[model samples]
Target: MSFLELKNIHKSYHLGSQTFPVLKGINLAFDLGDFVSILGESGGGKSTLMNIIGGLDRNFDGSVTIKGKALNHKNEKALDTYRRETIGYIYQSYNLISHLTVLDNVLVSLDMTTLSKKARVLRAKELLARVGLAGQIKKYPNQLSGGQKQRVAIARALASDPKVIIADEPTGALDSENTKEVLRLLNEIASEGRLVITVTHSEAVANAGTRIVRLADGKIESDKRIRQAYDRQDKEHLSSRPLRRLASIKTAFKHFRHNLGTNSLIIFGTAIGLFSVILFSGLGNGVSHYISSQITKVANPQVMSVSRYVKDSDDDNALSMSTDDTPALSTNQLDQLKKQKHVAKVEPTYSIPSATVSYQNQTVKMRYASNWTAASTADAIKIGHAPKKAGEVVIDQDAIAKKLDKEHYQDLIGKQIQLAYQTNKPSGETVTVSLTATISGIGHSDSKGAQVNAVNTETLQKAMQQAGLSTDPTEASVKVDTLDHVEEVASSIDKVKDGHNRLYKTSTIQSLIKQLQTYVNIATFVLSMVAAISLIVSALMIIVTMFMSVSKRTKEIGILRALGESKRDIRWLFIAESLITGVLSATVATVIAYLAQRGINGVLRNLADYTFVQITFRNVITAFFLAIMISLLAALLPARRAAKLNPIDALSAE
Candidate 1:
């Protein structure tokens, strides 16, 4: 039995219903240690026969039997395994992948095996050294001469330790000296007990082999043996070297580094996209914080203003000032509010309708006056102090400035002030009273609206009772334990159902804070979407770039296919390149965004009193992931194209 057999091989090409037969019923037998050359003229089907024997062309009608197993043309995996384990190819073009060094070109084959990284490198280096390319291993294919490139191709073929070495016009492009050198290497390879097959048109090249077969008009005309095939001695067992596998990461990195100028532009373009998203998001957060701080600065976050019910119309001053209709809060309601989560203290409040005040012959018709025990906790006071005794009062500086015909109303503090107001009792009777008290403090002018003097609730209530007015507090101020829980507590209070329609109306600076934040978020999302369009454009750029790369590396893809790489490997190689670019772009954008945030915040700090840009780590991670996903999706079409290319046609591509 022969080591390899081809039975009834037939191949042809078709052009618009015209049949052009290339090979006709060709049969051949091959054995280990045979250095056989197939010699023929142009169009004599020597190349077609070589392609069939090397497993590159499966369209032929034939049964290729190796070691008693026939090849299955339908099973791609089986064909790939056969090529990887049993056959090696040396192209006439010396198809060394241009991006790889001589050593890396050999290592490309070794990467398919299960050998360790160290073992693979050692074996690749050994193969290069054996081919007399030891010192030239670091050089690229373009840097080497024709002879040296051919030597590198030989070393790559030997790296996989295949039993069959197929050379298609291996010496076709070399000088006489280099051709002799390659021919001698082929004979040495055959002498190591492996089959060496070559296709050539030169009779002298065919004569160098142990056997010669001549093809004419698509059929073998003669087959003759010049001598017995060289047999290896016991001490010369070079074909038994173990196969070692290498990673493709190094290949991807090499490609990236080789085109740094182009790739750097891509990275920068992608980084700009990512930077915009981060910058806008950070700016939104900063603006939201600044607004929140400003709003809460005048009021207290932990202090919630509780009213019987909010007046639906700001013009309904009568409803607002009518204390008779004021809904009395029940003891049960106060207890419930105190028991609520995070509620620390609840203070009762009293109001007197239609109050009039006089100080030093300047009388003013004041709005409804209220006394909240928790008023001292608010930062609304601008001068003096909050009322601490029954007879002490805090006046609004703005209202006093108007009545006094002067600014700087702080002089009114520590002076006695007269107040008169009418209040309706539970008996439906109107009561009028007048009292005098010393002004204690002046509240800030920016306290939302025209404010009345604020006093202790107990002090005001006691005086009202003496005047025959109802003292059952009209409103209450609920103090939460922490500012963070103020909104939550307010929500729970609003949810408390009661028979009265005016159960509780909650208001705090938090409502304004949330409204501002909502606007910021909407603006940020819209801006980010606009920025993401640039990323989409960048993705399109990546697609175009990857397609261009695939076009340029078609021959390299063929070389890889010949080296036993699966289609999936080719796809992943391109995908990995995009992934690397994504990560690099993301890293650069994050750094730039962080620095931009610092610069903007620094400028804002000088202009205002707050930072205007704040970037979080979450933004960084999101930007990175978005960039990578976009890049990967963009490369899919190009990667698939590279993977599906025909190996034979790719090798023949210029």
Candidate 2:
């Protein structure tokens, strides 16, 4: 058998639902050290034949046997190996990765090899020098002349020391001078006992080859001998490592290095969207976590709370009742409410909302006025014991807005503070008073009064009188005899008219969480949506980048097809590039967001006086998922467009 052989081969393509046969029963054979030239006109399928031979396109019919192994319908993986290990390709356009230096470009395909880094570098330099690029190894593709770039391509083809070098008009893009210089490199590669199969339209280059093969309508019509044959090595000297399958992550990185200026600008452009999405989501999460924690710390979950809604709240014109105009329940209404089915023990409480606290004449208006419940409710306080009598008041941790020299977060607990108050007379006259009360307790509110404490009589009376005009009022929680009956008692409390304003302990706390959640949820929605816009922008950025790559590498994509890189591979290449860009962009975005989130947390933490919730590592992981999903999704459409490109036109485009 000849060193390389092809039995009758056939190929066809589909256009708009119709099948057209292109390559009809063509046969050919060749051997090592043969500089074989094939001359053909445009549209004659010379490149297609070269692509099939190089195993880039594996859809052809019939046998193409090399060294007794048939290359028939092998899977893409196997063909990929065949192309990487057995065939080296040179194209009309050099197709050097634009961002990589000549030497580094030569090292890309060998990424998965076990060769030492130094050895790899040395090998690349040696090959580049052999191709007359010794001094140009560090120069980027654009920095070199057209001939220099083609020489680098030739050196790259030889770097892995493949058994066959397939050149499809390698000299086509060059002027006559550069074309001759590149041809001289091909002649040298062939002279070194390597098989050089070149498809060209140049008659001069064809004359220098040892044999010439002519094609008409895709079949070899003539085989002409021009030189004596010489023996050559058929076994590859390099590893059969696959380009993208094996750990070519390094290759992708190297490719990135070559394209840094272009890709960096692209990635930077995409980051705004990504950063926004993460930040909003993260901030929302932080707020949610904070509120949830605050609620849990302040209440018991198994206990249910009952609240009364304004019956016609949905009516936009519902009458607005003034806080003071809403008449307090009468003693008879209170009695009727107490007699309800689940009637539990109840307390009568009084609140003077306009009350202010005074410390040596300085006062801060209380957001929450004096709140009194049945002594039972006092047990819910976090710091002190339950209170039994009037004048002794339990304070909220932040009730005092005044700057105090206190130490702990809840330091106002045992400190002495006074309640100053005023009352509006029925005749529309306002009266203010100087009644003083000591802090008898400090606590959080919850049902059951678990944390509640008793207030001493002295403080209780002071609060009642200091608020300008409160006759002694009693406040209580209905301690229902049974757990299930508690809800009934809570509901009944809502129907009561107590001659004085009264609020059920359970309803107030529930309303607090609901109100707080509403406000927080709005923030979460706004901030997260703001962040999502960034991710959307990032996706668009990725698409733009992939589109640019497809545009710039049109010639390379065509050459890849000619060298047996399938339409699939061409598409995959674009996808791979997008994924790479995504991964890189994600990494960058992650770093930025991570630092930003932490910085926010750091500032907030120091403002611990202002911050209630603590942000943790969970934020990082949340942001990571956002980035990866956006990245992969962005590449899908661009990859499809790349796959649909016609190789003939892509290659022919300048």
* TM-score for each predicted model, relative to the true structure: 0.81, 0.68
In candidate 2, what are the lDDT values of residues 1-654, reduced to their tens digit?
776787888888899999887888888888888899988888777887887788766677888888888875467656666776778888777777775678877876554345767888889998887877899877889899888888888887887777789998898888888877887788777877788999988788898788998888877889999888656744437674434433334444565666789889767655655665566666666666565455545433223332223343343122122245434434554465467675554444444555576665566666444345432343346665544444456655444522332355355554566665666755777877554445655665432222322334445555446545544343333345665665455555555543554432234334455566677768867876776766676677777877776787777665554334445555556666666776677667667776787778778775442333333366545555665666667767776777666555676778
lDDT (C-alpha) at residue 432 in model 2: 70
In Å, residue 218's CA in model 2 sits off its true spot by 5.9
Indicate the worst ten consecutive residues by lDDT in candidate 2.
Answer: 313-322
lDDT of 1 by residue, 523-590 (tens): 99999999999999889889999999999999988887777777887888898898888999999999
Clashing pairs in 1: 111-245, 111-246
Per the 3 Å backbone cut-off, how many clashing residue pairs does candidate 2 have?
Answer: 46
Residue 123 displacement in candidate 2 (angstroms): 2.7
For lDDT, the strongest prediction is 1
Instruction: Give me the displacement of residue 169 in model 1, in angstroms.
Output: 0.9
Candidate 1: where is the Cα deviation over 4 Å? 232-246, 292-302, 309-344, 348-475, 480-492, 496-502, 508-512
How close to the true structure is residue 572 of candidate 1, measured as C-alpha lDDT? 84
Best by TM-score: 1
In order of listing, the candidates' clash counts read 2, 46
